[model samples]
Target: MRNSIFLFVLSLISFGTFFQAQKIGDGETVDVNGLQVSLNITNKESVQVGGKPFDRYKVSASVKNSSDKSYTIRLTSYPQIVLDTGIVELDCVNATGAKLTSKKIQLKMKTQMINVSYSAYDKSGKSVSNVLPVIGSYYFDSGDIISDNAIFIVPSGEKPEVNVRALR
Candidate 1:
């Protein structure tokens, strides 16, 4: 009976911690596996995609890998919009250029390669080439802090706070 109760309590704690999310606002940092990541809303505007208008938010994500072992992180699954109505998951594009899905990154050991991944597109639904990184993966050596920006579109008039799931 005592062991069952202890196990139940332990499970409850683990479950809560697993689902816990951190609301990281502009310039706020979240640490995961000794990697420091900060996100900020750099700009916002209305953009045309597939002949429809959408509100797009340009977010800058910075990551510093300081751990001994490498880690892979997914930006599409981790980034979310916190609004008054509810939480909105950012739209993502698959590798084949399809919609409704997300992105992932790889952190290599030894060399400390931080695989930063994001999906970005321009007005014509093409990969952006201006100041933003395109829809692909990026790598950085270990112990190096790098800053990159991505464009995420959502409903109009909803200024959502950036929420990131710090997963291990």
Candidate 2:
């Protein structure tokens, strides 16, 4: 009876540890375009795009900003990619021809769907560019710290559109 009880207690402790590691919830708020936007993050077993498996440690972030003020936000997944040729590569791209080779890249929130807003002016005291909504998929070989950021332009005023399905 004592052995059985010990096993049961160990099982409970293991389960509790697993549950505690899985965290999902709303993240911090930031000024995107000209509006205050909130971000939501959720954990998933895997993330699929176009029916292709992207990553096992998958999470989704929902952004809320504006349609004005040009800015770029970026989301990074913690994983490293090594090509079969033994070359390490990181790919980041956007519709506007913006691309980056590092593990980190900046995304634009220019649409009204994502929740980015404009906020301030530039050094020239002119209204900043519109904010663009960006969706990013990261490919890595190992687990790392996953983080997302909402960037805003000075003298902000624009709000961008974000697509919900893209995050799925």
Candidate 3:
């Protein structure tokens, strides 16, 4: 039928129009100590979560260790989300969703939170921080844009390994 042919042509046009579509935020690299850290968001798709729809994005953190010895450090993503009110500065400790390589270096890809839900209230019911409001559990419209930066945290030793007995 003519309708079927028209549908096929429409599909082909859509593919040709966006054949080389890239992620929203990509092509960014940084150095953490002696390691190379590259961050990118890809595989974007419209998904539904908790009775709400969202455009979810997958984040990839590729770390390359050039040093001979393996380094032990955690990757903390500091996400700055732009909300309708203002930019919400996600805390380092509270927003560390995934921990990076504790042994070797490689690609650490994970699905990020699309419809992130959080209230700005402490146990005492006090508004401690500004909220990253989610509109209707899906669309996150704000004045500022959401952005992220990765930090390499050098884990501190639990206890001193000094020879206290020997010194005594």
lDDT values for all models: 0.51, 0.32, 0.34
Query: Candidates 1 and 3: which is better by lDDT?
Result: 1
Candidate 2 lDDT over 1-168, as tens digits, reads 999999999999868744433222245444322333333434323334445443222222333334333232334442323222111111121112112112212232332224445667889898876675533422222121123443211111212222211111
The regions of model 3 sitting more than 4 angstroms off are: 1-25, 67-168
What stretches of model 1 exceed 4 Å from their correct place? Answer: 1-20, 48-53, 66-142
Clashes of each: 0, 52, 0
The residue-level lDDT of candidate 1 at 122 comes to: 77
lDDT of 3 by residue, 20-67 (tens): 222112455543334344445444445444454434334444444433
**Best candidate, lDDT-wise?**
1
lDDT of 3 at 163: 8
Clashing pairs in 1: none
CA shift of 122, model 1, Å: 45
Rank order (by lDDT, best first): 1, 3, 2
Q: Sort the candidates on TM-score, descending order.
A: 1, 3, 2
